[model samples]
Target: MSNIDIRHAHSLPPEQARQAVQDVADKLADRFGMVTGWSGNTLNFSRSGVDGHINVAPSELHVTAKLGFLLSTMKGPIEAEIRRVLDERFT
Candidate 1:
């Protein structure tokens, strides 16, 4: 999938990054089949009925994290899936 821009930003210290990322994860959880679970250094979001995973990582001193997803070979219309979830949930 291609990159989609999201508006909104604010300065946040390193320690707050985890909470910020968690907020996004919480919203994503509302989407159908979007199960959110966290591990030590990453937050995992499963989507497309468990066919893919969106990996979220929050870096220090940044207001936003770099979010990435692993698309399944069987997954079709990957970008639309991501956009729908992000627009309805993250934005």
Candidate 2:
């Protein structure tokens, strides 16, 4: 019943970053049972008892991922997945 928020900074344009987020979301949608959709510069989804949101602005990619699970439970894997997705998109 608690939440954790994360913010990321990117060097890409908002539109591009939003697309990247959408791509990641698309890959994660059905399997994870999250509604992966884009609205403006934001991508939002929730699944596996967690809420995942990403916002893209010019030069920034902000992420807010939260789960009712303990931090120790979801932190590492989620962070790693985000890193992998970003690397695939932006690098």
Candidate 3:
């Protein structure tokens, strides 16, 4: 398995940051065919070959995902897309 862990800091307040993360999570779930569940401020999501969590906090969002071997080689593009979306949304 391969792992992707990224945490980005933001200046948005807790509520706004939470909403932003939730929106991103929803979009990701739709695009990736992920199933998600939430536990307080954290969203847990998974698909056939991936498992991850998005942790929302007052000043940051942390995303961590593990990919199965077949998908691991595409990690670069996956990470880039994630970074692009995060930058567009939070920066």
Candidate 4:
């Protein structure tokens, strides 16, 4: 398994940050068939080959994921897409 951990700083309020995370989750669910739910300030997501959570705070969002063998090989693109989404939504 491969792990990805990313922390992005943002200036949005807590609710807006959570909404941004939710939007990102919705997009991932639509594009990648991911299942997602919120637990407190954390948005958890999973699929066959990936599992992750995004933790939302007033000033930061932390994303962490574990990739299964097959997906591990594509980690670069996966992480890049995640960063792109975060950049678009939070920056």
Residue 26 miss distance in model 3 (angstroms) = 1.7
Candidate 2 Cα misplacement greater than 4 A, ranges? 1-4, 70-72
Candidate 3 vs candidate 4: which has greater TM-score? 4
The candidate 1 region of ten consecutive residues with least summed lDDT is: 58-67
Residues 1-91, candidate 1: write the lDDT tens digits: 3233333333455346556567766766764546777666456665553423333333221122223444434244644554554455333
Candidate 2 achieves a global lDDT of: 0.71
- Rank ordering of all candidates by TM-score, starting from the highest: 4, 3, 2, 1
Model 3: per-residue Cα lDDT over 30-50, one tens digit each: 888889888998989889889
- Candidate with top TM-score is 4
Q: For residues 1-91, could you state the per-residue lDDT of candidate 4 as single tens digits? A: 9999999999998988888888888988998899999999999999999999999988899999999999999999989998998898899
Q: Against the true structure, candidate 3 has what lDDT? A: 0.88
Q: Which of 1 and 3 is the better model by lDDT?
A: 3
Which ranges of candidate 1 are over 4 A from the true structure?
1-11, 49-91
For residue 64, model 2's alpha carbon misses the true position, in angstroms, by 0.6
Q: lDDT per residue, candidate 2, 1-91, as tens digits?
A: 4454656567776667766777777778756767776677678787667776787878767778777655547777777777766766765
TM-score of each: 0.42, 0.75, 0.91, 0.97
- Which one wins by TM-score: 1 or 2? 2
The per-prediction CA RMSD against the true structure, in angstroms, equals 7.2, 2.5, 1.1, 0.7
